[model samples]
Target: MATAKTRQKILQTFLDLLSEHPYEDVSLPMIAAAAKVKLSDMRSAFASKLQLVAAFTEKIDTAVLDGVDEDMGDQPPRDRLFDVLMTRIDVLAAHKEAVRALHVAARHDPALALDFNRLEVRSQKWMLIAAGIDVSGVKATIVAQGLAVAFARVVGVWLEEDDEGMPRTMARLDKELDKGGSFMKRLNGLERAAKGVRSLLKRISDRPARRRPRADEDDGEPDLSDKAPAGA
Candidate 1:
């Protein structure tokens, strides 16, 4: 129920403070002062510091996804996945401090970890679905999680390195993607297979049932209990 203006002010304050300090060193009072809002107001909007951090992280994720989605028109499936992931890496690299804070907070905050994972999984699924892949099966989920973790590690390395190592780091990812089967292709294949299976099952289930003869139509019922007692 917060006003747009108030939300904008809070976000601006957070960005300003983030540029000047590490995540661990930031406090509510400092953020309020930077945002020109009262500490109570900040607290009212975000229940805790961790929630503020999550909000900031979500804002960054949204911006990156928006940029990728805007530019993904008519691109091939592989290219779209690669482009989106690289764009996200670039965004995180540009906001290294903020990214670092979120990484650190994720280690100590279970809720943050769950939220972050959910966002990541959703984005990956969206990319796969856009590429005409089904994201319903267990295998698809595992593959998506694996790709996300790998991409995250790559981004982490890119953020931690200097200009000299950036090319080498990117080259490594390119080589990895090219040398082995493309992660995007695997995801798409799994999705297609899942869809095919689902379609087959649906078709089978939708077919008309065949009539069978009733038990009463038989000539007679066997008397097995009488025969067994006579065996003694």
Candidate 2:
């Protein structure tokens, strides 16, 4: 509908204004003026400033997700994860205003924060799947969730500084992944050791014990209760 287009235009205008000023300083009338739409027209599209901000955020999320899926197609797991993260960084850099607005709004909106958390989890799941890791178990799920949150924090730090560009962000990502690889290697070693210990115990328990002379026969006395000591 035409109303939809007008609403989108107003949101875009708001994003444009964000590039010029911080989100806290932006006003509805200023957004309307920038969009060249009347204040009443803007109100018709959104009931309130918060609603408008939410709509803008939804638009940006859609745009970023669309681009992410396209860039991630048919790649190897590690490549996919790297590309996905780099794409996110690039999208945020390109649409800094929209991203900044969402970041600002997330502080005040619990639902928005939840949405962001879910998005990160989804990304981590995809990466783990690509890596051929089984992400169904509780431990795997927790690792994925943790990694996603850590990655998001890294992206946030990158956004906070003007000098930390995409290449620098990508480098940081590589370093983080390297550290993750080391951690995973250590975890795998522990798992292997645990498995070995379990197997050893099973083998020992399953094997028949060597025959020995009864204690009564050796000492010419009846064995008491035929039971091993508590320590044994």
Candidate 3:
């Protein structure tokens, strides 16, 4: 089996090249050459570009999530998300140029976007976990998708943002969080409404069906047999 060390080397090389060139131009041979690895070794580590992207994202996710802040646990959801996303930005700052290039390419490439979206949603699930937020069911799915979009937008800003401190990037992130808060409120309302509907339907379903009138009652005939039967 290829060691983790070798795989990481290959991924990092691809990221470096991706930053310096267009995504369409960055081929497997370029990555292999940049990584100083044989083509065979590079293939062993990553069979294709999509696999390379997925592995790159997984490594980045692990880097941020593996060391979460206990302090964040005591914070509000928005604040926690702010910290989580900002921490990710800090990691991303190193590859801002590459990420910027990828974002532009993905906008024009539907196939790339679709494959990347899968990885992005998966990454956001971990980010939610890091932020002490739930990541399950329909509402959680919405939240995850929203965060993925928010992060992508932030990366766009971060790429163009030249300051060492990234003041503009921070401002954009805050705005996105504000928007997310509003969206979540609406989502919560919808979820509550849906839950209520489900509960009502359950009650209606669980209630015993209305008893039908007996045949004698329906016919308006008394049980004369019973009246006449008592020890007669």
> Which segments of model 1 are wrong by more than 4 Å?
16-25, 65-75, 107-111, 123-144, 175-232
Clashing pairs in 1: none
Q: lDDT for every model?
A: 0.66, 0.69, 0.87
Q: Residues 174-227, candidate 1, lDDT per residue (tens digit)?
A: 654563246656766877998999999999999999877686676466757567
The TM-score-based order of candidates, best leading, equals 3, 1, 2
TM-scores of all candidate predictions against the true structure: 0.63, 0.52, 0.88
Q: Give per-residue CA lDDT, model 2, range 129-180, as digits (tens).
A: 5444565766576667767766766666677667754566677788877777
Clashing residue pairs, backbone N/CA/C < 3 A, model 2 = none
CA deviation > 4 Å runs, candidate 2: 48-50, 68-74, 101-148, 160-165, 175-232
* Order of quality (lDDT): 3, 2, 1
Best by lDDT: 3
lDDT by residue (14-129, candidate 3, tens digit) is: 88888889888999998888888888888888889989888878878987897678877888988988988888988777787788778988999999898898889989989998
Top TM-score hit: 3
State the local distance difference test value for candidate 3.
Answer: 0.87
